[model samples]
Target: MFPSKSDFLLRLTTCLLSWVSALILVLIVWFLFVESELVWREVGVLRFLTDDRWSPSGDFSSAQFGLFPMIVASLLLAVGSILLAAPIGVGAALFAAYYAPRGVRQIFPRIVELLGGIPSVVYGLWGLVVLVPLISAYHPPGTSLLAGIVVVAIMILPTVALLTLSTFQQLPTSLIHSAAALGIAPTGIVRSVILPASRSGIMTAVLLAVTRAVGETMAVLMVCGNVIQAPSSPFSPVRTLTANIALEMAYAMQSHRSALFATGLALMLVVTLLVLIAEQQRGKAGHV
Candidate 1:
C-alpha cells in the first residue's frame, strides 16, 4: 500500500512539473504576442520584414524599422554553422564510437562533455581575442560572417557529437556483431548497418545543433562585427537577429521595445518551423 502511494505521488509530481513547463512556455508566447502587437500594427508585417533599414531609434516621424538585413545575416550564420559543424561533429561521433582505441573512446566522451560544459561567454571571449586576430591577419577586419559561423559551429559541435555518440551507443550490439560475423569490415558495417540504423537520431542531433546555431548570440555577436547588413561574403560583417535583439533590447523603448519583441516572435516562428520539419523527417524515417 505504501509503495503504491509513493508511486502515485511520483507520477503526480512529474505530471505537475510537465504542466508547469508547458504553462511557462505558453505564457512566454503570450507575452511576446502582446508586446509585439504594437509593431505588427504600426509598421505592418510586410514593410517591417522587407524594409532594408533598421533604425528604430531614428526620428519618431521617420524611424525606419526593417528586419531584412538582420534576417539574412542570421540565416547565413545559422546555415553556415550547420554545414560546417554537421560533418565534423558526425565524423567525431563515428570515430569515437567505432574507430577509437578503448582508452581514447573513454576519454573522447569526457572531452566532448567538457566542450559542452564550457560557457558561451568563454567561447565568445576566445573568439574575440584569438580567432578574431587570426582572421584579421588575412582579412582587414577579423569579425565577419565567417567568424560568426566558425564560433557558432564550435559552440554547437559538442551538442551534435555528444547526441550522435549517445545514439550510436544505444544501438543493439548483436546487430553489429552479426554484421562483423558476415565478414564485413568495420567501415562497411558502419556504412550499411550503423548509418541506416542511426539516421533518425542523426537527424535529430543535427536539428538540435541547428537550433543552437540559430539562437547563439554572445559568441557570434563578438566575432561577427555586428554590422547591420546582408551577409554578402565570408568576410562581410553582419548582425544576426539574436545579436540585434541583445544589442538593442536594453535601451529600446515604446515601439522600439515592441519591435524587439517582434524579433523574438520571428525567432519563435523559426523554431516552430524547425520543429515541424524535424517532426516530418522523424515520421518519414519511422515509416522507412
Candidate 2:
C-alpha cells in the first residue's frame, strides 16, 4: 500500500508540473495585455498600427507610436536573412549528413555547434568590427538593412544547419538504397529521396530560424543602423522593432512605455504562432 501511494504521489507531481507550465503561459499573456491597455486606450488600435511618424517633439503626449514601419523592417530583415542562410545552411547540413568524409564531417559539425554556443554579444562585437568596415567601404554610413540581414544570417546559420542535419539523419536508409538501386545518381537520390522525405523538417527549421532572426536584438542592434525611418533600399539605414524598444524604453514615459510593451506583446504573438505552426508540422510528419 505504501509503494502504491508513492507511485500515485509521483504521478500527481508530474501532472501538477504540466499544469503549472500552462498556468505560467497564461499569466504571461495576461501581464502583457494588461500592461498594453494604456497604449490601446490612448492611441486607439488602428492609429497605433497605421501611424508612421514615431518621433515626439515638444510634448511627449503627442508622440507617435506607429509600428507599421518597424514591423515591415523586421519582416524584411527576417526574410532576407532566411533567404541568405537557408540555402547555405541546408546545403552544408546535407553534405555533412550524406556526403562528407567521415573525419571532416564529424569535426565540422562540432565546430558549427561550438559557434552556436558562443554568446550573442561576441557575435555583435565581431559584426561591429568586421561588418561595419566592410559595409562602409561600399555604402557611405555603414549601418543598413543589408548589414543587419547579413549579420543575422550568420548568427542563425548554426541553428538552421544543426536542425537540417538532424532531419537528414532521421531519413530512412531504405529510400536512399532504393534510389541507388534504380541507377540514380547521388545528386538525383538526394534531390528525389532525401529532400522529399525531409520537407516537413526543413520547413520546421526555417520557421524556427526565422523566429530566432526576428527576435534577435544584440547582434542586430550592433549591425542595423537604428534609424526610425523605413529603408529606401537594402543599403539604407533601418530599425527593427526589438531594437526600437531597447533604445527607447529607458527614457519612455507613461503611454510611451505602454506602447513599447505593446510591441513586445506583438512580438510574442508572432513567435507563439510560429511555434504552433512548427509543432503542427512536426505532428503531421510523425503521423506520416
Candidate 3:
C-alpha cells in the first residue's frame, strides 16, 4: 500500500512537471505577442511585412522593422544546410538500417551518437579554426555564406541521421520482403518500397535539420560574416536572425531591443508553423 501511494505521488509529480513546462512555453508565446504590439504600432502591420528597409536607427519616429532580409537570410542558410545534410544523413541511415555489417553498424552508430553529444561551442571552435580557413580559399573570404552553410550542415547531420535510423529500425522486415517478393531489384526495392514507406520520417528529419539550422547561433556566427546585407551568392557573407540576435543582444536598447524580440517572435512563428505541417504530414502517413 505504501509503494502504491508512492507511485501515485510520483506519477502526479510528473504530470505537474509536464504542465509546468507547457505553461512556460505558453508564457513565452504570450510575451512575444505582447512585445510585438510595439512594432505593430510603430510600423503598422502591412508596412512591417512588405517594406524591405530596417531603419531602427533612423530619425523617423516610427523606425522601419521589415524582417524580410533576416527572413531571407534564415531561409537561405536553413535551405543550404538541409541540402548539404539530408542526402548524406539519409544515406547513412539506410546503410545503417539495411546494409551495414553488425560490427560496422555498432561502431558507426556509437560514433554518430558521440557527435550528437558534443557541445555546439566545440563545433563553433572547429569551424573557426578549421572550416573557416578551408572555405576561404574558394570563397575568398573565410566568413562567407558557404562557411556558415557547411558548418550548420555538419552540426545537424547527426540529428537527422539518428532520427532516420530509428525510423527505419521501427519498420517491419516484411515490408522490405514484400518488395523483394514482387521480383524487384534490391536498389529498386530501396527506392520504391523503403523510400516511400519512410517519407514521413524523412520529412521529419528535414524539418528537424531546418529547425536546428535556423536556431543555430554559435557555429553560424563563427563562420558567417555577420554582415546585414542580403547575400548575392553562397560566396557572400550573410547574417541570419539568430546571428543578429547573438551579436547584438548584449547592448540593444529601447526600440532596438524590441526589434530583436520581434525577430525572435518571427522565428518562433515560422518554426511553430513548420512543426505543425510536419505533424499533419505524420498523420497522413498513419493513414497510408
Q: In TM-score terms, which candidate is top?
A: 2
Query: What order do candidates take by TM-score, descending?
Result: 2, 1, 3
Model 3 is weakest, by summed lDDT over 10 consecutive residues, at 279-288
Q: How accurate is candidate 3 locally (lDDT)?
A: 0.81
Q: Which ten contiguous residues of candidate 2 have the minimum total lDDT?
A: 55-64
- TM-score per model over all chains: 0.90, 0.93, 0.89
Clashing residue pairs for model 1: none
lDDT string, candidate 3, 1-288, tens digits: 547988999999999999999899799988987876666567565765676677665433657666677677878999998999999999999888889998888887889989988888889889888988888876678888888888889889998899888878777888888879989999998888888888888888788778888899888888888887788888888888898889888987667777777788878988888888776765655212
Candidate 3 at 70: error in angstroms? 2.3
Off by over 4 Å in 2: 1-4, 56-61, 286-288
lDDT of each: 0.87, 0.85, 0.81
What does the lDDT come to for candidate 1? 0.87
